[model samples]
Target: MQTGENEQALRKIIDFTRLLSIAILIIHFYLRCYHTFYKLKLTHEVVDHILLPLSKTTAFNTMLFAKLSALLLLVVSLMGSKGKRDEKIRAKTIVTYCVTGLLIYFFSSYLISWPWLYMGATSFGYLLFMTGGGLLFRMLKLRLGGDIFNKENETFPQEERLLENEYSINLPAKYQLKGKERDSWINIINPFRGTLIGGSPGAGKSYFIIRHIITQHIRKGFAMLIYDFKYDDLSRIAYNALRQYGGRSFYVINFEKIMHRSNPLEPETMLDITDAMEAARTVMLGLNREWIKKQGDFFVESPINFVTALIWFLKKYKAGKYCTLPHVIELSLVDYKELFAVLSSEPEIEVLINPFISAWRNEAYEQLEGQIASAKISLARLSSPQLYYVLSGNDFSLDINNPDEPKVVCLANNPQKSQVYGAVLSLYVNRINKLVNRKNQQKCSLIFDEFPTIYFNGIDNLIATARSNKVAVTLAVQDYSQLKKDYGREQAEVIMNIVGNIVCGQVTGDTAKQLSERFGKINQQKESVSINSSDTSVSRSTQLDYAIPGSKIAALSSGEFVGMVADDPGNKISLKTFHCEIQNDHDAIQQETAGYSEIPFPSAVTSSQVILNYQRIKEDVKILVDDIVDSL
Candidate 1:
């Protein structure tokens, strides 16, 4: 008797636990429905009245009605319970009850009396009921329908894991870059991918790049390398600001200074292969000192370093042995020690080393010589306070190691000089690449502004492979035409493809067509008309034909852009433009230019003025035509 009583007590406890679980699930379902309804504004009477009420019920009545129906289903389902067979029946019955309740509620709301309460509840309540029913049905289907839901499940495995470490970093919204969508400045994924800013010469491409550096990258403590080949007044201003931001340790290279170097062998004209080789050599040597110390005796230079391994290969080439950088790079991995020994033995290697050393030594001496020469020639000139103020007005000193404050390094000099803008860019990229590759740092962003002018040979390779090393590069270019003009069509395409993100601003003509094709197809329509008539008695018939054909490419506005992300290459996201506050660099330049005297000459008139003059001439032609017409 005692055993029987204990068994009965355990059975009651199990039954109560099951009842509590079911109650919790039901409550959760109702709360989800309520939340969804609130979000969609479906609980409001105003919307229901505007669309015409579907029923005479209140939102509370509709909710109560659903609950009562569900309770009835539960009671009826439990009353029929027998065993395991009854459990399956009960699950199916509950799903059916929920689904029927939703259908009945929607039909009465939309097709029947159109009450304000029913209309409001219909929007979100119907959605909730359907979702809950679907989930329950799926669970039942997985158990009883031979795992049909399991077979059809398409959820990604990785998505099930929590994203605890994926914190988002916010960017300031009021950047004044020009565009709507206040939320547009939020965390951007893969910003280093190529972004194209298109407009005419005065369309503010340089301005945007400078702002990005100062406000976004530098201000955030991330380093940036800019190559401004146009040598615009804006570049000079940016450089000055960078100098102030990053004290004396800040490295600023001017291409004009390289030309002024005492080395007679260094080419004074356009940058050729030799100049690139030299620049690469200098950077490699600088990097090698640290690499060697880190590796100690085990240090074997890879051909990618451009110093130890590449020098060895270049030496062989001088002695009638043919080789390329790629070949040396390939062999460097296989026989690093042998290559390092060969590199150390090369006599011709000294030719490259000597020039770099001489240039480095002469830099300070040249600065001293200029000071001495200026002092001797200008006792009176130096005494003039105004002259001193004008000549020595800007300070260019920066300390790079200050962690508390952000450092800004701006190349606001002539970019055309291969050594200054071009060399600095190359060195900066190489530095970051080495740091990431050797040390394995997971976060670093490199921004290359005005990219075309600083064309380096291996930039494409870097873009393609740098992601693996955690080095991200953002290349900002004016247009596709500019890229093609700078790097040729094939190379340009290769470089563009390597980048995973493409953001474009206003573009037209060939570029527009190209971008449109890349983003996806645009929908077009045409209209046609036909008419026919027949008479039984007179056998009269009539026919008519009309046709219209129209087609238009996708038109993107100034701040509007078509964003294509590589992760979802097929998806074309339309992003609102970034609004950036306009800086007064242009205004300052205008003021400075105004101070200079202008001379008038026949040849000095601009093309725009010449077009105006031609228009004036055309006015005479128009007068002649008017006289001829009058005479006729």
Candidate 2:
């Protein structure tokens, strides 16, 4: 009862003070206006009684105190009587408003002589402080609470600014920020540093990312070598892009059709017998991927050395006229004695084959056969008529980036025959990497789709070193597990880490988790709400979390991609990471594709002619063996 009585007394006092301040303001305004405009002069009695008692030192000062008292009374009334507590308002804010208002009102004393100027300035000051200060507090509250509904930290750095240049591939994209969609771009500022694209099938990796890379790089006149693992899908794109973009030379090495043939072991490009040893290493590892894990094993080294001796022998035989894969396969299948006899006759490789010779002389034929059998068996799988016709002829050189005659080359592999076609394709990839990764060559791009279908021995090294040589390599795979399964874990990790740009679509398991960790973390806000029968409470908090969660990566839509890119020193990109949907003009691409013509056959050669050519290569190998034996 006593507390209620005290509250009522305080309310009465506040109301009386408010009314008294209003009356004082009215009296001061009226007296100031009448004296300033009408030139009214007060008698001494009126000045002493009315002006000195009511107006104090100045009418403006009297009005300022009255208005300030009224504002303070309102604040006191609210603070003393409240139902729900306001989390926004604090004692500090109330004190700040009071001090700032007092300073501004006192500073307006100079305008007191001009009644109109004083009133206008006071009114402006009241509106500016009270109204604007209230709004600023409200903004502070909202910022502290954050956007709890959309929990993502959309405060990421995103810019609509795009950087384009002769060596760049700019992709149009869009991202979300605070529930608003904004335009963005994935700027491949320096593609020479290499790009790795990973996603599941139907993830739009090829449709959204790879196709753009192909068309744009081709448009820029880059001598390209594309590995179409699914055959004509990318091959057709390469062909049409070449025709539309005006390339100097175009070639496709496909075994299933009338395709151009290029020797992977071309003599002028192989450089030396060590190059042959490298080729042997690549082919042996490609054919026997399990051997990648067992690289230093004697059996593995034996086969690689045997194949090297054969390749170097052919490269030496008749000035390398027969230094082709078909010839190598034919010679590898020859009798062990004759093969060793013919290879050992070459003084350069005598020591290379001495182990086999010692085993043969000692009648340890089983041990000798064990070493040579793997090579013969692996090389035998590639001994197809179509494969021979494709790999034996020298329709063009492997140096596609020869600036004088820049070539746009696409080599295709059949999915049904990946094992057979993969070996030959790996050889091409190995050879082309060596040729294209040289100084002063035409700027080139090597795009490998379904990269795990074939093995690239030094793919990590190529990506690491190719940037300076102007060779852009783009590798696409279904998942990191596939890469680990095919390329071995150590090599797969090296390839994954070496690339400068990475774009990924829907993927799950370790791949998604790995990508999530690669994207790093950002500060994000989370809200929790609790309700009881009597009351409800809400709380907000912030913590460092994955910018793109692994679940988000696993749940990414078809056209959505999340990745980071490299930037050149001259063309720096501040926001290198992204989670965006590549905006492709489907209508334009479809219409353009509709106008594309079929790739023309370079010759009128028939399947029977291909068979005849295959037989002739075998006959050449047989006759060469005979001549070498006769000379010995």
lDDT per model vs. reference = 0.39, 0.82
lDDT of 2 by residue, 7-92 (tens): 78976776665555455555565555656544555335654467545555543455555666645654444444322224455546
Task: Give per-residue CA lDDT, model 1, range 1-632, as digits (tens).
Answer: 54988767865665664464345334423343544556766566664454223223342245455444544444433443322222133565557657765666446444324334444555445445544443453332223244342221211111111111121122332231112222233233444443444443444445534344433443344444444455434345444444445432233333332111111111221123343344344333222322212322211222122333342444354341222222222333323233334444546465533432343356655543332222122122212222112112123222222333323343434543443234334444443333333234333445566676553556677666655544456666767778776667777778766666555545556665665555543222222222234211112232321111011112333333333433323323344222222234567656744553321111232445434533443343344334434544
**What TM-score does each of the candidates earn?**
0.37, 0.78
Clash totals for all candidate models: 22, 0
Best by lDDT: 2
Off by over 4 Å in 1: 1-187, 192-200, 208-210, 230-249, 256-408, 415-438, 441-443, 468-470, 522-560, 565-632
Clashing pairs in 2: none
- Against the hidden true structure, what lDDT does model 2 obtain? 0.82
TM-score (C-alpha, index-matched) for candidate 2: 0.78
